[model samples]
Target: MQRIFITGTAGFIGFHLARLLLDEGFTVAGFDGMTDYYDVRLKQRRHQMLLQSPGFRATEAILEDRDALDGAIDAFAPDVIIHLAAQAGVRYSLENPRAYIDANVVGSFNVMEAARRQGVAHLMMASTSSVYGAETAMPYVETQKADTQMTIYAATKKATESMGHAYAHLYDLPTTMFRFFTVYGPWGRPDMALYKFVDAILDGRPIDIYNHGEMYRDFTYVGDLVRGIRLLMDAVPVRPADPADIAPGDSLSPVAPHRVVNIGNSTSVRLLDFVEAIEEVLGVKAQRNLMAMQPGDVPATWADASLLQSLTGYRPQTDLRDGVQRFVDWYRAYKDSGGLR
Candidate 1:
């Protein structure tokens, strides 16, 4: 069985990914800081469930703690390392810019260093579509120049991408940076729009519709996103003998065994349309508070997942309505169990 070390195993994406891997008989060691960003109970609930798996073991520590991080990695000695833990919120980045620098930038550096020392076969980390800030292109591609970052959150994630490239070039570590679109599903983060909207609607509170509900997003379901990640794990990139050998849309670096892939639903859905699906799922009407665009937020995000499909022979195809319904069901159960508090 493959041994994998994953950061943020207590997080929304990490929890789901770990579950999938464990179900496949892979041994997973998880690391998480358990920050009080949202609800610590929620994070704990996730970890508690993962602990049920005999193959799952975890270390509770912040990514900023170099000693703890290095120690855990060395102990696990995993064949693959997936770094998914970060202070993740676009608007919150405005309130606490330092958090992003500490978690996304500094934390990611520590992981890269550990990967270098361990000589891991592959190092995969999470990047975001927010990195494609200020670009109005419909279906953002991996090869596009993503230099204009709107917020400190995006800037930090973009910084990680650069750092990963440099480490791959220097150490010959096979690295893959995933540019995830707006990911949502069951066990979603409370700070995310879907979770907030669902909770507020259920509680008879007004839901804030940013950008006057005109925004668009390529809301990739968590299941599809993780599946894309699983496939990419096997499709490791290699430094091409010649740059011309790479495909037209490939983002493979000519100087290193590094590449950036976009994982998202190819279709972009309007914000209002998404909310409508949520309302339909829960059988409740949301009191909408149309608000102006918040700082450090984009009006829309669409992903060109062609590279991901070409590499993995799979694409994220879950319909928004079906995915929202699943989340609503899970939310009801969680709320009834007093897990939402």
Candidate 2:
């Protein structure tokens, strides 16, 4: 069994990914900051569940604390390091721009440094589709020029991608950077749209519909997203001797063993349709509060996941209504069991 060290195991996607890896009989070491960004209790619940697996152990520390992070990584001596911990939120970046810089920029540098020092076989980091900012192209592809980032959040993530490429070139570190779309499922963040909408609707509060219900997102299920990550673990990129030998539509860097892949459902669902799916699941009508587009908000985001499929022979195709129903069920059960109390 390979030893895998993962950061942010207390987070939404991290929790799910850790659980999946544990089930596959991998020895896993998890690190998390357990910040009170939303609710520490929810984060605790995620880690608590993972602890049930005897193959799992975790360290609680922020990524900004380089000593702690390095200690945990050094102790694990992992074959692979999946860097998932970061200050994550698009809207919140506007309120605390420095937080994004501290965690996403400086903290990411620490992880890269550790990976290079450890000589890990592979280093995987999470990026976001928001990096494709100001590009009007439909179905965002990895080969497209992603220059015009609109928000601090997107800019920081883009910076990490560039940094990862540089490290891959200089250190010969095999690296994969994933650009994830709107990921949702059970045990999701309270700040996300599906979670907030379900909670507000259940409480009989009006739900905010930004852009007057004119938004679209490539809502990738958490399960599908993590499976993509797992498969890509084996598809490590190798530096191409000749740039012309590279396959078409692949984002692999010619000068480095690094690549960027977008993990998404490949379909853009309208925001209104998503809300209606939630309403149908709950059998409750949402008191809709239409609002103008918030700053740093995009009207639509769709992913071209062909490269992901070609690389891994898999694609994320979970149905929106089915995924929404799963989340609703989990939400009801969690609330009944005294969640958020």
Candidate 3:
């Protein structure tokens, strides 16, 4: 069995990805900061569940701790390193911009250096759809120019993409950066929309509808998002001998063994419609709090997932209502189990 070392295994997407990989019989080593950014108990619970699998082992440490990160990766000697740990939260970036720099920028650099030294076959990192800031283009494609970054969070993620490209070019590292669209599902982060909306509604509180409920998002289910990551792990990018040889619409770097793929549902659901779906799932109406768009917030995000489908032969097709139902079920169970406390 192949060994995979994953960062942020206690995180939302990372936890789901680790569980999936563990189920597939891969020997997995996980590293996490277990930050108090949200409820530490939720993260701890995720780690506790993963530990049920004998093939899974984990180290609790922050990504910014280079020595700890390097030690864990070296001890595991994984064939692949998936870097998913980063200071994640767009609006929170406004309150704590320096945290984004510390984790997303400096921490990402450490992961790249470790991957280079280990000569891992693949080094995959997570970027975000937020990086497509100020670009009004519908169905954002990977090949398009992504220069405008509205917040420090997006800027840091964009910085990591550029950094990954440079490392791939200079050291011949096989690197892939996946841009995730508003990922939501079971075991989702409390900071994300679905979780907050569900939590507030269940507690009889008003749910904030930003942009006056006119916003849109390509709400990619967490399961589909992680499946894309797993498939891309095998579709390793190769530096093309000629730039002309690259396929049309492909985002493969012509000068390096690197690629950036957008993993999303390819459908932009209106914010109001998403809330309605949640209400339907819970059989309760939400106290809607209409408000102006927050700073650094985009009105919409839609992904062009053709490149992901071409590489993986799969696309995220989960229906909004069905996904919402799944999350509602998990949220109810978790809340009943005193997870919300």
Instruction: Provide the lowest-lDDT 10-residue window in model 3.
Output: 332-341
Task: Tell me how far the alpha carbon of residue 82 in candidate 1 is from the true structure, in angstroms, after superposition.
Answer: 0.3
Number of clashing pairs, model 2? 0
Clashing pairs in 3: none
Error of 3 at 57 (Å): 0.9
Q: Which lDDT value does model 3 have at 173?
A: 94
Each model's lDDT comes to 0.95, 0.95, 0.95
The sequence of per-residue lDDT tens digits that candidate 2 reaches over residues 1-341 is 29999999999999999999999999999999998889999999999999989999999999899999999999999999999998999999999999999999999999999999999999999999999988989899999999988899999999999999999999999999999999999999999999999999999999999999999999999999999999999999899999999999999999999999999999999999999999999999999999999999989999999999999999998899999999988999999999841
Q: TM-score per candidate, in order?
A: 0.99, 0.99, 0.99
Tell me the tens digit of each residue's lDDT in model 1 across 1-341: 29999999999999999999999999999999999998999999999999999999999999999999999999999999999999999989999999999999999999999999999999999999999999998789999999999999999999999999999999899999999999999999999999999999999999999989999999999999999988999988898889989889999999999999999999899999999999898889999999999988899999999999999999999999999988888998998989942
Residue 284 in model 3: shift from native, Å? 0.7
